[model samples]
Target: MAKEKFKDAEKGNAVEKEAEDLENGNANADAAVPAPLYPKMAEDPRARWAFIRKVYTILASQFLFTSAVGAVGAFVHPIPKFFLSGGLTSIVVFVAILLSPFIAMFPMLIFRRKHPINLVLLAIFTACISCSVCILSSFFGVKAFLEAAILTCTVFIALTLFTFWAARGGNDFTFIFPFLFATIHVLLVYLIIQLFFPLDRIVYTVYSLLATLLFSGFIIFHTESLIKRHGYDEYIIAAIDLYLAGVNLFTSLLGLAGIA
Candidate 1:
């Protein structure tokens, strides 16, 4: 009887020890799991607002830099001519345009954890785009440039407000992605056609109008994505997306104004 009792006690102790070990293992597993670096911003109002603010601030700064560079390029007589004359400026602009996507991706790929490096790459990309803008604006003259800038800003602001309202109404813009992808390819084909066969004035005007509208849609979609779809850590990507939309809008407006 004592031998049986001793064996039962040993079994009980072993089971208790096994349960204790399982609990510890569970605790260790829980502790080992790391927190997410990119949290959903929609869950936190303060965080969302802060992220929006940072994104817009960066966007505004980029706009100002582009404008300043464009103005300098336009007024400085030799600069525009140099770029337009198929010379150094043209080569630089071409190279920049060709390499911009890679340059922009560089920070995201390698230096994402380093803010200074990301900022530098962003600035360089912005500068390259600004140089191209400067060359294009030079053809339009200052008055047209100013008009296009004003119109672009007005349209952008209106679309941004609409995006905010749509977000408040819990609208999802994910459905537009397929349409946008198709439209972009169509636009690219149209541009390639323009390169080979010069489009008539009416066709050019139509193209510009359509381009402006498309970019306006993009602005809304990107803004909505920034607010609702993107994580809090995606500020750089958000800024770049918005900046491209704005720049494209301005260029389309410039073309529509018959200045390009």
Candidate 2:
């Protein structure tokens, strides 16, 4: 009887020791992974409001520059003529303008967090991309360009206001990102195939509409992300996110207007 009692005591001690080790292990694991602090930053009203103001200010400046460049490209008679002219000089200029955005993007991304340099790089990137956009706009002429610009602005404002209201109501739009990402990849593949075989007019129209909606979803997602997910120091990235979505939406709208 004593032998059995001793054995039982040993088993109890072993189990207790194992449970203690398990608790320690869990504590270590938790310590190893530091908790994210963005929630704290995002929760502060002053910080959140400041971040929003900075991001929107930068975005507004970019759009102003883009609008100025677009007007010059569309309404300036000589500018359109020069770009449209089928000559060696025109071809060279067109190719350079097309390639400029890619060239600027690399440095802009690299210096995205480097303060004054980052701002300079952002300006260069904005200029290059805006130039490319305006060049494309020139091809559609003044009336279509103006209409698309107005529509893009109106849609952007409505979406911005809606996103703010939705976010304030505790709506999370980040879940749609995976679906949007997958669909955009599929659309990209379809567009590449179109280079070899031209799509039917109806098909192209459908594609354009799909792209416009996709970008609209992106704007909403990114805007909500700005409100809830982005860190305090991520203002530049936030601006870029909104700007890219707006530009893509504008291009898609421009395509529709051109076709119409």
Candidate 3:
């Protein structure tokens, strides 16, 4: 009986040690894994769709507001005349162009925390951009403006659909970043050159064509980034990116149509 009791005690001690080892192994495994960086939108369809809806809603609103401002800027005699009078030679228009980007960025930086201040800043930025667009549109006339608007809409819709299809097929656009960066730099150089040596109509047309293609690609990239990479909380930034893409695409098309 004494020998049997001693054997049982030894068995109990071994089982306890094995159990402790298993727990320690689990703890180590848990420690080895890191937390996720963004919300798991991929796993939650509803959350993903909600985020997408918010982004597009804001984008549409901005577009409509811009369009209204553009229309006003185009029709009002004084506004159009004032903007086009001196062309690039006009000090007021030149100053506005130089300052517009900084003005737009200021609001984006200051009111980034989601407040009424952001809305106010967004309005100001949109107004500035709309004024610029109006100036460009006035040079093109009503017919060119309408044609460009139609083309822009068609292209935007098509690209958006393609982006969704590609994403569903498990394709990410990570490979295009380097090419986009290079192309954009080349375009910037061309733009700077044009500033010094005004390009002829044919060259301007070619530049506009290239710019349209580039911004179309940008739309795809920005949309995919919004859907796959950005967190749900980044709706504001995503909206801004998409809005810029749309605006650039429209302007490029307008130039290609020989209106700007």
Best by TM-score: 2
Q: Against the hidden reference, what TM-scores do the models get?
A: 0.76, 0.81, 0.78
The residue-by-residue lDDT of candidate 2 on 70-91, one tens digit each, is 8777787787788778999999
All candidates in order of TM-score, best leading = 2, 3, 1
Backbone atom clashes (below 3 Å) for every candidate: 0, 0, 0
Residue-level lDDT tens digits of model 3 in 47-140: 6777889889888988898787666655566765665577665766658764796678776766665776776777677777877787777777
Clashing pairs in 1: none
List pairs with backbone clashes in candidate 2. none
Tell me which of candidates 2 and 3 scores higher on lDDT.
Answer: 2
**Lowest-scoring 10 consecutive residues by lDDT in candidate 3?**
34-43
Give per-residue CA lDDT, model 1, range 49-132, as digits (tens).
789899999999999998887777556677657666887767876677647756666665465446877778788878778877
lDDT winner between candidates 1 and 3: 1
Tell me how far candidate 1 lies from the true structure as C-alpha RMSD in angstroms. 10.5
RMSD of each: 10.5, 13.0, 9.3
Deviation in Å, model 3, residue 75 alpha carbon: 3.6
Best by lDDT: 2
